[model samples]
Target: MRVLAIIVLALIGSAGAEAREAQEGRADLKHEILKRLHDPNAARRRDALLMLGTFTDVPLSPILHSATDDPDPGVRAAAIMALGHASHASNAQELIPTLLRALKDSHPLVRRAAAGVLGRVRDPRAVRALQEAARDRDAAVRAAAVEALGEQGDQAALTTLLERLRDKDPFVRRQAARAIGRLRAPTALAALLERLVREEDVDVKRAIAWALGEIGNPHAAETLRTLSRSTDPYLSATAREALKRLISDATARSRRR
Candidate 1:
């Protein structure tokens, strides 16, 4: 009994010491970041924002929020991303407004970062802002916004996502197809089918096929069957796998019925 008590005490002491050391380390890191954030060099300030992203435990929201307005677009973008890392379910709603504003930043990089982070936060309030961003001039920004809208999982954004399927940028079109797949809206089947036939980009076609499979509507089976025989190995394999999922899902539904 004495030996067991001694072992428990030793462990408790060791854990206490480790916790104190971690706390001190976080304090030191916070100080360093705060000092660099005010430095004259924009690069240093940006690097500080990136470092701040790595430590979410520090009380750094005020500093990060202010950094979002930094003259340097790169620093502003980094600050937006750091805010995303600092956010959790409890505080995500509070951060949505900042991200929404960033989504409209003049710099495409800042807008793209905001869209990406808004998606990660997955707040319903951001849906409208993200929808607008989906029409951004920059293809990358549009793609990121489309992806974020899918992440929001609000069916209300489905119309916007479907429209993006016809975006001139093949990458945006691919992202739109993927976002639609994530939503798994059966109503999107016809649009996806139409896009699949017209899409010249193999990657976009593959995404359409994957979306069809994800929707799991039996109506898509015929199209998937044709795609399953494509000479392109990745598309063919994806189609075959999608067919399997459709079969599995349909079988499960029938059993439940």
Candidate 2:
């Protein structure tokens, strides 16, 4: 019994010592990153922000928060991305204000990054800002904002996403279709079907088909069946898959009744 107790004590001591060493190592890394963030070179500061972003286990929000104001737009964008990486559900809401401000940054790249991160944060408070960003002049920013609003899953942003389905940019339209699918709102069915009929972009058509499948509306079954006969193998396959989902969902609903 005495020997067993001594062995247990030794193990506990070893574990405690290892934990302390890891904590010290993390502290050292944090100090080095902080020092580099202040470097005169913008690239160096951006690099530090990138590195800090990967330190998800560390509570470095203060440093990342300040970096968002860096003079270099690239650095500011990187800081916003880093903040997204470091944030989790518990602390995400705390940073929504900072992200909202970045969403309005004069630099398109910075605004794009902010919109993308706001999606990761998934705060309802950002839904309105993201909806506004969906109208950004830059196509890339608009695409990012549309994607973010989809991530928000708020029904309030549904109208904006539906409007983006007709955006001049095919990429934004594709993203809008996918976002509508993510929402899985039956109300979006008619819009998705309408766009699918008029969409010349094969990629956008495929996204619309996928959205129809995700919504699993029986009304879409006839369209999906006709689409399944299309010459484009990819589109036909997507439509066939959507039909399967509609059938499966119908079965589920019947069983529930």
Candidate 3:
């Protein structure tokens, strides 16, 4: 009994010492990464900012806040995603204001990056900001916002998503259509069905078809059946596949009932 007690105490001491060593190593690595933040080259600074995200759930804290306004748009954008890596709740909260501010950044790249980070953070509070960003003058930024709103999957964003369906940019419209599906917005069924007929962009059409399948309203079945016979092989195949998926989901639901 005495020998067993000594062995257990030694193992515990060794584990504690190893944990301390790991903590010190992590601190040293962070110090090195911080030094690179001031690198003469913007690309180097951006790379350093991204490297900070791999710090194994360590909060970048004060440094991350300042980097949000870095002169290089790329660095600022990297800061956006790095903020998502913050493991501490308080540190992550610091990003909320910065993310909102970045949505209005002069550079479209910064705005788009902020939108994506907001989604990755998965904060419901960002839904309103994402909705406004969806109307950004830059189509890519608008698309990013739509994608972010989709990640949120909030029904409140359905209106903004519905409006974006008519955005002048085909990419924005396609993303909005896809976001609607992610939100499972039932009100969008009519719009998607209407767009399927007049939408000239094959990519946007495909997105709408997919959204219809995801929504899976009985009314959409006729459209899917008709499209199943389309001369466009991809569209026909997608429609046929969507029908099967919807039918399967409906069957599963009915059985559960």
Best by lDDT: 2
TM-score of each: 0.92, 0.88, 0.85
Summing lDDT over every window of 10 consecutive residues in candidate 3, give the lowest-scoring window.
85-94
Candidate 3, residue 74: how far the Cα is off, in Å: 1.1
lDDT by residue for model 2 (1-257), tens: 99999999999999999999999999899889979999999999999999988886666898899988899999999999999888888989998999999988999999999999988776667898899999999999999999998888888999999999999999999999999999999999989988887899999998999999999999999999999998999999999998999899999999999
TM-score of candidate 3 versus the correct structure, residues matched by position: 0.85
lDDT of 3 by residue, 163-235 (tens): 9998889999899999998877778899888877878887888788788889978788888899889888888
Worst 10 residues of 1 by lDDT: 120-129
| Clashing pairs for predicted structure model 3, backbone only | none
Instruction: Supply the global lDDT for candidate 3.
Output: 0.86
**Which candidate gets the maximum TM-score versus the true structure?**
1
RMSD list, candidates in order: 1.9, 2.4, 3.3
Question: What ordering of candidates by lDDT runs from best to worst?
Answer: 2, 1, 3
Please report, in order, the local distance difference test score of every candidate based on alpha carbons.
0.92, 0.92, 0.86
Instruction: Please list all clashing residue pairs in model 1, or write none if there are none.
Output: none
